[model samples]
Target: MKLSSRRKAIAPATRPAAVKAGKCPICGKPQDAGYRPFCSKRCSDIDLGRWLGGRYAVPGEPVSTRTEEDDEE
Candidate 1:
């Protein structure tokens, strides 16, 4: 292999590049690599709590609860 061709293959790996960091979706803060998408543990926990508490609900058809009368019928 030619030296030029070898350099071309290795050039990509040696380049110093700027990485664009993403903001947290929950808190509008710079995203942390540890938590990811959330700035801190608290924000991550808040997001989870929202999911568990049904605060973050998906748009869908409302489900009707079966009544005792409906069950008897």
Candidate 2:
């Protein structure tokens, strides 16, 4: 058997699990390869706008704004 053919036969067995191609998170439409988890440029932009507008936030302890000088004063 040819070396190339053997490699091809084994490739599928060694490959990782295929990613699920599901609906877009933004609009519930089929995802596009170009936009990925989003369906279209419009959906992708909408997601971005939400992040930039502070609609999405990561929860954490509030950061202190005062520095050493402020503490001393």
Candidate 3:
């Protein structure tokens, strides 16, 4: 009985969780059917709040200034 309960609890957690365009990045909550992307209105609003709250950000890459033969050429 304990094993069954544990299995049930762990079943959903074991499912594939991804950061797709329409899926929630913070949690594995499915996109809402009405929200058309988020699993629910609350999740969708939360995502928006995070964005508005500046929780998400774009990462920058390091730039290379010198060429391999800069001195020679």
Candidate 4:
């Protein structure tokens, strides 16, 4: 119920290591069904969308609107 600091830090290490040890990547709680890392089709697709969508990105600056052509452009 109570994890020591060491255990808390090591907790994350355990899941990925399951993969490193040849376990499922998705869910990380199921058997690998030839998904190679991911445990299921759903999680695999979710991760793919995250990477492709630019979700992890810096905040974009707002465009200035002082130019006369700004409305046309």
Top-lDDT candidate index:
2
Q: Please provide, for model 4 over 1-73, each residue's C-alpha lDDT reduced to its tens digit, 9 standing for 90 to 100.
A: 4556665565444566554566455556565566656667777787687677677664588977688777685
Output the better candidate (2/3) by TM-score: 2
**Once superposed on the true structure, which residue ranges of model 1 sit more than 4 Å away at CA?**
1-20, 55-73
Better of 1 and 3 by TM-score: 1
TM value for model 3:
0.37
The C-alpha TM-scores of every prediction are 0.46, 0.47, 0.37, 0.40
Tell me the tens digit of each residue's lDDT in model 3 across 2-73: 666765565454434354445655466666668756677777788788787675555456878878788684
Q: What's the lDDT for residue 23 in model 2?
A: 68
Q: Model 2: residues >4 Å from true position, as ranges? A: 1-19, 55-73
In model 2, the worst 10-residue window by lDDT is 10-19
Residue 55 Cα positional deviation in candidate 3, in Å, after optimal superposition: 8.3
lDDT of 3 at 22: 58
lDDT of 1 by residue, 1-73 (tens): 5767766565455334322566777878898889987899989999898887685566577888978788883
**Which one is best on TM-score?**
2
Model 2 over residues 1-73: C-alpha lDDT tens digits? 5767766565455334234656688988889999988999999999898887685565667899878888774
Error of 3 at 69 (Å): 48
User: lDDT of all the models against the reference?
Assistant: 0.76, 0.78, 0.66, 0.64
**Candidate ordering by TM-score (highest first):** 2, 1, 4, 3
Q: Look at candidate 2 and tell me the lDDT of residue 8.
A: 58
